[model samples]
Each structure stands twice: as C-alpha cells, then as structure tokens.
Target: MSKVSASRAFRRRVSLCLLSSAASLGLSAPALAQEATALPDIDIDSTAGRDSAPATAERIDRSDLRARQTGSSDTAKLLQSVPGVSGYSAGGFSTLPAIRGLEAQRLGITVDGVTIASACPNDMNPPLSYTDPQTISSIGVITGVSPMSLGGDSIGGIIAVETAPPQFAQTGETLLTGEASAFYRSNGDGFGGALSLIVASDTLSLTYNGSYTQAENFEGGGPLGIVRSSEFAKTDHSLNLAAQTDIGLFELKGGYHFSPYEGFPNQYMDMTSNKSWFVNGHYAGAFDWGDLDVRGHYRKTDHEMNFLDDKGGTADGGMPMNTQVRQAGYDVKADILLGEAGTLRIGNEFQHQWLNDYWPPVAGSMMMGPNPYINVNGAKRDRLGTFIEWEKSWESGVTLIAGVRNDQVWMNTGDVAPYGTGMMQMADMMAAAAFNAADHRRHDSNWSGSALLRYDLSDMVTVELGYARKTRSPNIYERYTWGRGSMSSRMIGWFGDGNGYVGNLDLKPEKADTLSAALTLRDGGEEGWSFKVAPYHTRVTDYIDVVKLQDFTDMMGMPTGFVQLQFANQDAEIYGVDASGSVPLWSDERFGKGRLSAKASWLRGRNESDGAPLYHQMPLSGTVSLEHKLDGFETRIDLTWAADKNRVDPTRNEPRTAGYALLDAQIAYSWKNYRFTLAAENLFDKAYSAPLGGMSLGDYNATGVLRPVPGRGRSINAGFGVKF
Candidate 1:
C-alpha cells in the first residue's frame, strides 16, 4: 500500500479501538417546556414581504439591544438556549463551538450587523469568544441555515449580535443610569461598568461601556498535569450616540479593545500583544414602499507574538519565532424592500492589510548556517463581495427563503531586504518563485446559495427543513505566511520534523454540503411552554487540516521527534441535534411562584476517509437549572454534565476522558432600578478535558498543545447593574 493509504489504515485501526465507546441518548431529557414568553419568536418573513401581516408581533424586545445581560458567563453559556449547538474548551478564554459538526471560518460572526474580521490563527475568535456576554443586549445564532443578507454561509452557522436601540429620555423625563459590576473565579477576575444619560426635549441619547480583566494560569485537571502560562489581562471600551427624528434614525458608534497577552487555545499560536479599534455610522428610515437601511463601517487590528518553535524536545532544538500583523478594512451595505413579500440586501466590502513579520536568529539554529533566518518583510490582501436574499410566507403559514452571494479576493506577498539579513532570506525566494510563477497575487472567488421551507402546522407548532451549498475560501493566513505559524508555538511531532506548521498559498477552498430539519412548539400565547429540536449533517469537501512533516535527526544520527505541519484539503462529516426548553415551576395563573429551565445539545464528527472521530466533536452535554424569585430577589442553581469520549483519530491521539459534571449557582437581587447578581462555574471542582482525546499530542512534544490544560475548579463571580 502507498504511504498515505498505510497512514489511513493505521488511523482506522486506532479509531476502532475506541468505537464501542460511542454512546447514544434520547433527543433531550424532556420534550415540552414553556416559559419566558416562548423567547419572542423572530419573524423571518417580516423583512421578506412588504405586505406581510404587520410584521408578526416581535416577541423579543429590540431596544433591549444594550445594557442587558443573559447567561451570566461565557459565550457558549449565553447561547445554550439556541437549538443544535454545543461548545468545547481548550483553555479559560478559548471556546470552540460546534454547530452540528462544522466549525472554523465555516461560521460567521457579525456585530451590530457589520462583519468584524477575526485574526486568530487557530479559529479561536468565534462570535462568542470575541466579546463579553454583557457587552450586547440581544443575540441570534443561525445554525446551518442563515439569511442571505449575511452572504448565506456557514455549514456550522452564523451569529448576529445587536446592541439595543437607543432609548431616549421620555417627553418629560430626564434619564440617568450608571452601575459597577465585577466577576471573580478560581481562574480569573474581571470588573467593568456602563453609563447612560439622556435629555427628553431633543430626542438625543448617549451611552458608554468600559471593562478590565486579569487572570492567572488555569489548572488542567488531568493525571499528568499540563502547566499553562495563560496568565493574562486586558481592557475594552465602546461609545454610542443616536438621534430619533421625523425623517429617520441616525446613530454612530466607536469601539476599542486591547490585550497585552492573549493565550492561544488552539495550541498552535498565541498573541503576546494585541490591540483593535473600530468606528461606524448607520441610518434607517421607513416609508410606504418599504424600509431603507444603510451603514458604513471601518475596523483595524494589530497583532504581535513571541514564539518558541517547539517544547519537550519535540524538535531537533527549539527555535525562536515572532510576528506582527495589522489589518484595516471598510465595508458598506444597504437593505431595501423590493415589494410585497420581497426584499433585496445588497452590499460591497473591501479591505487592505499590511503584514510585518520577523524571526530573530538563534545562537545554534541549523539549516546550513550558524544562525539561519526567515520572515516576511510585508504582505497585503484585497477583497470585495456582494450578496442578496429573499423571503416570503404564503397563506396557511408556508414560508420559503432563498439567497446567493459572490466574493473575490486578491493577495500579494512582498520582497526580501538584500538577502541574508535576519528574517529576510525568505523574501528573495518568494519574489523569485512569484516572478517565475503565473500568479504572485493569489486570487480566489467563492459563491454560496441556500433554500429553506417551513410550514406552520398550527399557532403552537412549526416544522422546517432546508438545504445549502456553501463555500468558505481560505483567508490570508491559509494562503500565505511563510516558514511557520506565529510564535513557532504550533509544533506537531507527528509529521516527524517538529519544526512546526506553516501556511500554503496553493491551498484550495473548503466547501460543505448540508441538510437539516427543525421542529418547534409552544402552547400559543396562553400559559404555554417552548421547545425546539434541530438535526443537521454536513459533508465537507476539501475540508482543511494541518498536514504535519516530521523526520528530523539528532547529532547521534538517530531520528529526532521535531515536525512541521501545513494546511491541506480532506473529507469529513458532522452530525448532531440540539434540544432545549423551559420547564415552569410556578404560574401566576396557577402556582404562587416556582420555575425550572433546562437545555441539552450533542455534536459528533468523523473523518469520512477512515471513519475516525474528528478532533473536537463536542461531547453529549446537558444543563438543568432551577430558579426562584421572591419579590425582587431571584436565585438559581444549574447542573451541567458531559459524557465520555474515547473514540478518536490516532493522528491526534484523542484521549479517553471520563465524563464529568459541574454545579453553577447564581443569586440576583433587585430593587427599583438596581440589580445585584452572583454566578459560579465548575463549583464542584470536578476536572476533565472537554475533549480529553487532545492530550495524546503530549507524547510527541513535552510542551505539545495536547498537554492537558486544567479545567477550572470552584469559583464565584458577582456584579450589579442599573437601568434608567
């Protein structure tokens, strides 16, 4: 058999060793649950048809776009209410969420309707991972099937974050509100506050938010401990202004975020230092023909890193690494109703980035020199895109939705500074290669399309099914960036070199074929409960994975463990279901007062080529919460558990992590316009890797990404807020 075939066979055998460990369970613990106003269902058809029925009453508050906090914790925690979703953790701040079985760039994130580019090398800045849960008022997670205005993508899903509309002071009332809040736990501490003031007569409003956080290394609860230097801190701020007038609404916003050291949860790259800022303007107006919307946005981020080629003798000898990246981009979009039940969303987006990379020479670095060097003098990327979508609901509640998007991108890598000067040698080779090749500016184009149909059986029930063809073109990192990843932190010994991994410009786009179905229910408007279940499976073609290169030799003439890895295309499959609902304990119409709410989700993936489990198939997880409110004070306790996952691909050494549970309790007291809150996570001190199978990498590198990072122990966080 060929070398690649042999490799596949070996991995298959290894995967078979743990196949029996795959367990199964019911869709969810309980089926029916109703409370919390059925979460104010969204009227997807409202924007589609100008003649739609008064735009189906909005069940959720839209002005609630600001100063509202839910899920009291991480992004995954806050999104638990959404069906068909789950998340896994590689570190304290790193949360990798799986929609069905898809992840990475396959998922899209938008803030206040503008796409905010992510700079994380390991796919870590998922929507929830970017901002604190308290920073926004309302959140919507669209799994697999999303609106066309969003460019109609994500085999994994799309996340939309919106700040509440400005609430001007009443006609005769002056408004003033400010509050301080803080959170601390076994792993970290954070504090922040928001303030808002408004004058009634002019219909003008102002708001501002600021926060700071600091944390130490989190413990990885494993038999062989994984020591982590994730100790880090940062600050964030945002300002907003809005005015309501007879013609329309106008708003402006500016935001800033900075971090000195942000650990990489992906085990491949880390940000030793970072800063980002953004500004935006928006206008919305309504008329008899339809609603008109327009927006202009600009954003930029600078990233710097300190890297070590490898740890734990995984390489011939560890090498030092470094990088600096600054990206600035601007985009514009307009949404105008077409007529009746048709609306067109058209937009253009573009960006230009400048990259400055450096790699200092090592005292005894090998490669034909006493001290060899590699780095990019500079690099650039340009992109443009336009897209549109439509929606319509027929009589008897049958709805149809469709959308399409096309995007074009261009990238250029610059020259070397007179050869052998530190980190400049690679430039000469790059320019030569580009000059000899047909294309130095690697160009790519991607197209996406999707269709979904839903039939409302009754006022209390709805069933929907959908299919989508989507493609996520490789970003700049996947196409260029010579030598290795930022900081040389990503050392994979499996490839035999342990030198670390690098990006490839010749890589192809990753695409997905998806099919899904969703069932939703609620008892109408009368003392009813809400429940929804969604199941989807995606076949990823040309899925990207880091292929490692290892075969280094030590001075003794024997094989050494160092390795290098690069992105490549492969096939994979993801399947799973999400079920969640609120179980009421008391009814103002029935009991005096009592309540119960719970949610559960499961995600699984397999390498289609060999049927091996993917690296991070989020474990079967569930949460149960009970709450009680007395007058103005409310208290709740939650229990969350995940099942065992030993079925893993041998390549990644997926482990056999035992199942574990955690207790999270909270208390909130409120009076007048003030609210006090407290929350706890991993309260029992139980420790286990969410994806324990990841630990196997440690065998190759003493400091491998698989080093078991600790799950947090018992911890408590408290905060307070006031709404004017």
Candidate 2:
C-alpha cells in the first residue's frame, strides 16, 4: 500500500460508503442554504407525469423547444412527436432515432454527458449528428425502464441533450446576451440559421453557438414526385467557458461539425463528407460530504460515402466509402445527501473507441473489385462503468428509486488482408479465413439493475412501478464483420434498410428483463388537466437478431438474389403502450384560451424463437391536438396517425405499410424579447408511407414498386427570434 497509501485508502472507502448509507437510514443533512443555486452541469430534466419523476421520463421544455423550431434541424425530428418515438429517414438531415423498438447501437445517445461515436459504418453519422437543434436547452427521454444511473450499455432507451447553462452577473454586474434565428421551408427549398452569444461577469462566462442547414430535392406526395437523393448540407459550431466560485461550477466546451453533402434516399450510401471535433470538461460542486461531479470528453470523426445521382454515378461503377472515428470519455459522480429522506449516487465511467473502414480504388474498377477495400480494418472498443444510486422519500406518499450497474467491455481487431483481383481474390480469401478464425480478442462483463416506485393516490392521482435489468454489448459492428461468400456486410448497416450485412464473430451479450407501469391524472394546479398511461414489458436474452441469409453475394462476386443479413442469437419479446393527454377546452378573460391534446403509441415484437415478427416494428401510432391562447397569440392544430404495418418479418422481407393521416399547423407570436413562427407541414399533400421509413433505394414511383419511403410534400414553414 504505497502510491499515496493507495490513494488515501480509496478515499476512505468512499467516505465509509457514504457515511454508512446515511447513518443506517436515519439520514441527515438538509440545511445549507446560504446562497445556493447551482446544479446544472447535467440534470436530466425530470418530468413525465412528475410526482417526483421517472415514469419513464420525458421532458422537453422551453415550450417544447419553441414548438419544434419549425421544421428539421434533425434532432431526430424533435423526437417525432415523442410517444415512444420512431424515425429512420437518412436524408434531409439524417433522422435515425428509435426507442421502444430499439435502434442503432441500441440507443443511449447523450450530449452533455457526452458519448458520440458514429462515423458512419452505415449510420450516416448519427448520435443526433452531434447535436445542434439550436443548441438544445433541454430534451430528455428514457422510455422503457432505464435507470442504473441513467442507463449504461443499453436496452434501447435514453437520449439526453442539453446545453444552455452558465449565467451569472450581479454585484457590480456586466452581462450581454444575444440570440438570432431564421428558418424557411417549402418542400426542400429549405434554409436555416441560428446563433447565440453571451458574456457575463460576477464570475466569468462566455459562450458562442451557431448552426446552419440547407436542403433541396424533396417533393413526394403523389406519383412520387422529386425525392432524388433528398439533398442536405449542415454546419455547427460551439464554444463555451464558465467559472463560478464559492466552490462550484466550471465548464469548458468546444465543438465543430461540417457536412459537405448528405443524401440517402433510403440507403446504399450517400453523404459525401462529414467532419467533426469536440472537447468538453465540466465540474459541479456543493460539498460538506455531498454533491460533486466531473466530466470529460473528446471526439473526432471523418466520414464519407458515395453513389448518388440516383445511386449510380461517381463513375466506374461507383461505391466509395471511408470512415474514421475516435472517441474518449470520462465521468465521475457523487451526490450524497441522505437525511430528510435519502439520496445517494456514486458513479464512474470511461469509454474509448476507435474505428476505420475503407474502400477507394477506382481506375478501371468494375464494381469495386480491386479498390482499397479494408472495411473496418483496425477496430477497437473499451468501456468501463460503475454506478450505484438510491433515493427515497416518505411521509406516506411513497417514492423510491434504486440502481446498480457494472460494465466492462473490450474488443479488438487488427491483421486482415487480401484485397481484390480474381473473384475479388477469392472473396478476400474467404474473408481472411473468417478473420483468422475469429476470437480477435473479445471480452464482456456486464450487470445492470433498476427499480422504481412512486405512489401518491390523492390530490388527483399518481402511480408508477418499474423493474429492469439491461445489458448490451456486441457492437464493434456486432462483434466484428468479416465478409464471406460473395462479400456483403460492410459492418452490418444500421437500418436504412435496403439490406446487405454480415457480422457475427460468435456474438452474444444482450440481456434484458423489464416491466413498467404508470398512471397519472392531474388537475390541482399542476396544470388544468392531464393524463398519462405507460406500460412496458421486455424479455430478451442473447437477442441480437437479424437473420435473413438464404444465400447471398454481391459487390462483383455476383449471385445477388437480394437478401443478406447476419448477426444472430435469438429469443426475444417486447410489448408496449403509451398514452398521453391534456384538456381544458375553454376559458374566459374575453374568451381566449382552449386546449386539447392526445398521444398514443403501441408496440409488439416476437421471435421468441420462431414466433417471428420482430424486425422493424413500429406501427400503431397517434397524436392529436388543438390549442389556442391569447395575449401574445398562439395556435396549433395537429393530427397524425398510423396503423397498418401487418407485422412482417418473414426472414427480413419485412414490408407492409399502409395507413396514414397527417395534418399540422401552428402559429405563434410574442412581443418583448420577440418570437414569431408559422408552420403548416403536410397539411393536405398526403401520400403516406412511414413505418419507420425504410426501403426504397433511390427513386422510382408510378408503381415501379420499390416503395415504402414517401411522406413529405406539403410544407410551409417560417420562423423568427430575437433576444438581447
């Protein structure tokens, strides 16, 4: 025991395990209010039928981010009206989200807790494209029972995005703020703008923000008009710094992003180039034996893809690709205050990832038979996590939360060669003998847990219950992709679904068990009226499915009967329900108020080994609205619906969607700090298709039959903003 006495005996065993679990539950410590108000280095905005939070958490404030900021900056389409969300359109700004049906590395995206990695291995740079929905101030979602200190690994759920914090100025004050906004849309003659700035004193602060977007080619209503490659462009920037005293708050941030072009009429490449950078640091404090936090981040990316101009240009039989990634992470936490009812949080986290995927040869290429073709050449992954959480409350209204987590993942790869010539060099020598007979270093160790309860049966009701045990490991392109036979599988495409994938180096590590429930009804000044209903169920075990492989081969080795997929381990189940409400249909003060709202979601999945049907599930959906206000004007109208996805999977032939309805409208106005908006989206141009919008690889209609990828035609948007 040297090394500074083993780091002072591990901080005295974590301060005696947080003071013996808060003095054996007789708690204490809730009386320190001498100018206190600083807790936002990260706070997952709790509120989903509140009663002290977590009823499958959901929160999106700032007037729902100013009513969705009038059309796409693609923060996952602003969570697609949020009720178990769904999305998967790879252009006009990269929409990808999916929860309740899981998606992409099984969902656990963050920002401001920073975890961002996706330099397109067919993901087109998702992770909400490194955030920039006008510098999001709030957005949270946790559908499904996520806990274990806000989800680790993942079982599909958790999205957090935050920014906007750091303001201090008084006592010999000095502050200066700014904001600006602009927007326009009309079926892809799109436009965008955003900016923000701030400066402060009374403990230093500074910030700068930016955004830009562009679009073209998007018109789809009847006869499948336009829609060619569904164009796009993007840019983002950030910088921040902060410092505050009396022992707390410190921050630093930096960011940059760029996109030279983007387009992906549903898969098989398109996204010319993307570049990224990031840096982060944070700290928060309140001690006396309690609250402390720290964070760190780093990111880098470079992505590229090709084949557009309706999927066959870029000359010489096209098919370009490139990817690069590097990510880093850190987190540390403590929040011990147990007395007037409990609170204890302990954390540690670490992440590291590196990647590479290549392809570039040309010069008399016939279909990429002899290019550079390395495809995920030196992959790596590492994760280490720890968590422990507990919360309590009593006085007979219940409320409890519990958590536990542990993770250790490691993956490695290197050494793989064989590139093109006859029959693509015998298909890269059988994919380098199956990547040298697999086991290119792998490891996994996981454990997770969660529990929640909340009760309050009066003052207009509340109830909640939850349970969980989640884990997911097996990403590194699902445990390494090593092409074979005819060579498809460029790291198992992430649901832009025009299929072609392979990966499975003895994959395993996906375990889940969940149960959840919620019910809430309110009226007693929490608002005029409200309602909620949540339900969930899950059961998975080694479920990393994606079968469909009746024989394949493409990319010049020929044979393509067009079905290829691989990544196995089965047995699964999923269930869901979600509902929402709001009411208040009239008011006075010279009659200027009204309201009504609704939401719905439904889900089902199976493949509990042969029960089939669990590929891209998400059908039954709903939304409705009507609103009005006065004194600064406001209005709304909405109606969205869906149902008719005949549950198809049949070995990933999955296609069957028919059911649609949509209509939208909005208006707003404000004075003083200024605001203005106008929206209309798809009001009547209906030619629907969106069951997770997949399929359809580049242009065709008038019954050419490669359908399922429509929706987007009647638009009318506008925006405005100001602040000073």
Candidate 3:
C-alpha cells in the first residue's frame, strides 16, 4: 500500500480501538448532551477543592514549562519548582516525586485522571515516567490537607498531571493542527523529540502523540567521571478520541510504552525490558441537578530485570527477575448545588490490582537452578472508596469546607516456593513454608476526613487553616514479599539504598492526623506582588518502617556493607514549612518587563516510636530566579541551593551529603510559528552529591565500597519547536 493509504489505515485502527474499549467498559453517550465547547486555559490538572484551603494548588505556567522541557526529559522533575517537593533519583527517566518527606506510595500521582502503578521491583517505571514532557498541558501540586474529591489512599498530598484536552472546531468547520519539537543536551549526549497531531470537526476530534528519548552515561563534576549504569532509552505513543453532545463530553485514550533497557545506578539490577499498554475513558456533563464526571482506566505491564554491561553482567544473564502487573480502576463524582452559597460533592472510586513476581532459574548455577523462585505469586489488592464533601461561603468573607471518606481494602496471595531443595536454599524454603502456613488473606477498613476554614481579614490579607485524618494500607511488596534469603531479600527493595528487605504480612494500615495553616499577602492581579507561607504538622500511627534482621561480615571478619531488614509498624511525626513570593521588577513598552520569584522549604521527620530520624528527608532547599521578557524573546537565571543533611537514619545507615548551590540560565525566542531555545545548567561545574540519590551500586561494584551518587556536571542544552 502507498504511504498515505497506510497512514489512513493506521488511524482508522486506532479510532476503532478507542471506540471498542469504551464500549467494553459500558460507557454510553448522554442523550441531552450539547456540542463540546473549546477547552479553557485554566489549570487542567488539579481536582476541585476550596480555593482558600491550605491545600491550594500551585501550577507551572506554560512559559516555565517550556523552559524546563529544554533541560530534561523526566516528567516527575517538573514538580521540582513546587515548594516542599523533591525527587528520588532512579533511572534516567524514572524520578519519584516526594512531598515533604513522604514519597513512593504515599503521594497520589495521576496522569489525565488515571493513576498508573509501578510494575517493576526497583520502581523503574513510575506513573509519571509513562508520560512525556512534550505532551503535558499543565502540572499542579496540593501540598497538604487534600479534599476527599481527589480520592483516598495517600497521606502526603496529591500531584496531578494532565495532557492537552480534546478540542473541537467551530460550527460547520474542520481543523487540522500539529506540532514537532526536539532537544539536545551536551552532558550525557542526550537527544529526543516529540510529534503531536490533531484532527477535529464540530462534533468529533482525534489526536495522536509520539515521543522518543535516549541518553548515555552522564559525567559528574570534578573526579566523578562517567557515572556508570545511568543510561536509558524509551519510546511512547498515545491515541485519543473525543465526541461532544448537547449534554456532555466523552473521551477515550489508549497508549503504549516500551523501554529496551534502563540502568539503575542505585539498585542491584537494571531494567532490561519493559512494555506496557493502557486504555482510559472520561465523561463530563451538566444536568438539571448538578455537574457529573466519570473516569475509568485499565493497564497491563510486563517487566524484566537483570545486570547490564555497566553492572558486569555474567554470561548466563546474572539472575534474571520478571514481574507482571494488571490494574483497573473507576471513579465517579457529582456536584450538587445546595443553594446560592453552598455546593455538595459526592464521589465513589474503585481499584483492583494483580501482581506476580518470580525469578527464572539459570542452568549450571548451584544456588539458582532446578526451580523458579516465587517472590510474590498471584497477589491481589482491591479497594472501594466513597466520600462526601460540602463547601459554603458566607457574606462575611468566611468560607468553610468539610469532607469525610471511607475505604475498604482487601488483599490476598497464593502459595509460594523456593528456588531449589539445595542446602543454599534452606533459608528460602523455611521462610516460604512459614508464609504459606499462615493466613494469606487480609482486609482493612480505613476512614479519613478533613475540615478547612478560610477568612479574609482584609483586601490584602487572608488566613486559612485545616485539619485532616488520612489512612494508607501497605503495598504488595511491603506485605507479600516472603523471601528471607539474603540474595532474595536484596532483590526486593524500592528505596535504592542497596540494602536488603523482607516483608511482613502482619503489618497494619497507617493513619495520619495532620494540621496545616496558610497566610497570604497579595495585591491581587496577574502582575501584582504576592507572598504566601504555609506550615504543616502530621502524626502517624503504625507507620511502615524497617528493623534489622541480619548482618553480613567482610573478608576481615568485620561487620560492614548493607544488611538485611524487615518491614515493621511504628509511630512517626513529620513537620514542614513552605514560603514563596513573586514581585514585578519593572515594566516598559520598549524594554519589556522583568520579574523576580523565590520559593523555599524546610522539613523534619522522626520515628516517634524509637526516637530515630526518618530516611530520605530533604534538607532545607530553595530556588530564586530572575526573568525578563521582550517583544518575542525571554531570558531567565536561577540559583538552586540545599542545606547539609546532618540528620541520618541509623537503622538504614543513610548517607550524609554536604550543602551545595548551582546556577542555570536560559534564553528563548519565538517568531511566527517557530520557537528556539538555549540553556546552560550547573554553570560552574561544581561537584556535589544529591541527598536523595541513595547508595550507588555502580560505585560499589567498581571500588568495592558504596558511596552516594554524584550530581551531574555542567551542560549546554538546545531545543526548537514548530507548530502548524
């Protein structure tokens, strides 16, 4: 077939797939729906909540987003601009976002309204990693005291990401539009590009997006040259279809992702292969009584892990590990107008997950031969949640919002087995037996609620206070991993600390009670000066930490290196404060305008049960930037700094990192339908270690000792984009 014919055929197939998937999910078009209107430019990512609550969201503007895209490809890195948010570095593309000191499963992260779970043992394919930066429309973060409308399951807060929404052309008109962009960075010889296309009519629209990114090992400053096992390559594709009617809008999206190889510098293995496919559907409508929204999604993943060349792989593939995940969920919400001054929101959500993890045997290997090692076989976790929220505003400048939620979680797992019956496998055999003999099914009923109040003291000042009770159940890896052998335990940690971990089925759900307050002083307007400060404190019962299980000795009969640990429940406390401000420097018709912005945060976490410091807490950090804009050109300079990490977790043996600061600069110009960008990062080439980088297994393998991962050196970046 001709190229044009082939392209048409592919588009038809994708459209059919979207329709069929939506139909299979029992989605129906509304009878009274009206023609879809043009999507607004308002923030698209944040779920609805009281505007005056301490959970007020912060958004990354389009211009700032464009600048950040020129420097990196990781989607989670986009949240770094939000105060009290940090990142846990894993692979080149998988950086887990951390709010305050809580990370991983503690933060609710969603893409276009669908939540995707990590499928690998090392967490190399986190939810944000599935979306490419070039396609993102906006990113928003709610730091504390989140509302029940955002769903239940997280304690820290919510991080919402959204891609461009469906667009419809004017009445009786047709539209065809697209954009192409690419970027290159000097430090890692990294390069990537993205392509987006959309076809729309008055009532129907179709869109396609594709991206590819790859990078080599990046060099650290000074003596830290060519940090090994930090390379990766990835490709993603997505198709979306939308229909607008008199009463509502319906959308269906389908996507695929693949990564041939992605190195993990901090873990014991690298992701050799990863493939995932997903489908999602959404509906929004206006009714006589209220507004309604519905969403549903399903995803499946196949992942594999083993040693790569940088990690000294053996001829026999060095302990191959495999994992598979299947996840499905649905959410329904409705807004009912109580009166002219109040609104009531009610929602229901459900999620079901199935997982399997096993290691294949290697022929001619004494310890890993004869049978497969079943790590977490046929594990299942399901949750059903319901919530009701009310918001009311009084004429006296007082606003009150309150909500309550309940979740019923159920978990179960099938029997497991060891690698073989050899003497080397005795520990695994015993542990497996004990796990199988115990009750494999468990259930948890958790409740959460929050209340917020906002009062306007004057036109230039506002005060907001809130309190919340949140609960989270342990994940599959935290409760079902039954391996007790050293090597087996070493294969099951997501913290990237190079330490071994074993799971405990008797773990209890964590409940956190939190209090937060925010004070704002603003002049009210796009360019007006504004300053805000927020402080929050949380106390958690039955927090999942770890306890030492066993220790290993070196050649000299001395205790050294990583040790085995087991998950346990404990009490914990976390507190933090965030401050941010922005001011206009000058505005001129001929010379353009200038602005200055600053944000900073301080955090502390402690295990109240044992009086020990928590692991992976971010030190005092902040960023200051100056920006200038001309007719069609923009320039920006930023300084980012962090304080020394003196508080350490003795149990986990967390490392300490010295404080360091870095400078970055960028310039961009737009003409017609084209944009060009240039940027420089780490301008001084100063060597420093990232506090959240974890222990570098690559360094340990090379020097026979573990060390903190080094930060990337200075880099020059360039990019360009064209729209039609």
lDDT (0 to 1) per candidate: 0.54, 0.75, 0.83
Candidates in order, TM-scores: namely 0.78, 0.33, 0.93
TM-score of 2: 0.33
For TM-score, candidate 1 versus 2, the one ahead is 1
Higher-scoring candidate on TM-score, 1 or 3:
3
The candidate that wins on lDDT is 3
Error of 2 at 218 (Å): 7.1
Expressed as tens digits, the lDDT of each residue in 1-724 for candidate 3 is 6332343355444434433432322222232123444654322125542254443577665456776887988988778889888999889989988987899678888888777876777788899888878778777688878777777887878887877788887889776766667777899877777767778898899988887777778988767787888888778999999888887888899999988778888998988889999999988887787788889999999999988777876456588999999999999888888887698989898999999999999888889978999998989999999999998888888888799999999999999999998999999999999999999899999999988888988788888898999999998999999888878888988888988899999999999999989888989577889999999999999999999998855668777768889999999999989999999999999989999999999999999988989989999999999999998899999999999999989898899999999999999998766678999999888799988989888768877767898899999998877666
Overall local distance difference test of candidate 2: 0.75
In Å, residue 508's CA in model 2 sits off its true spot by 10
How many residue pairs of model 2 clash at the backbone?
2
Instruction: Give the per-residue Cα lDDT of candidate 2 at 697.
Output: 70
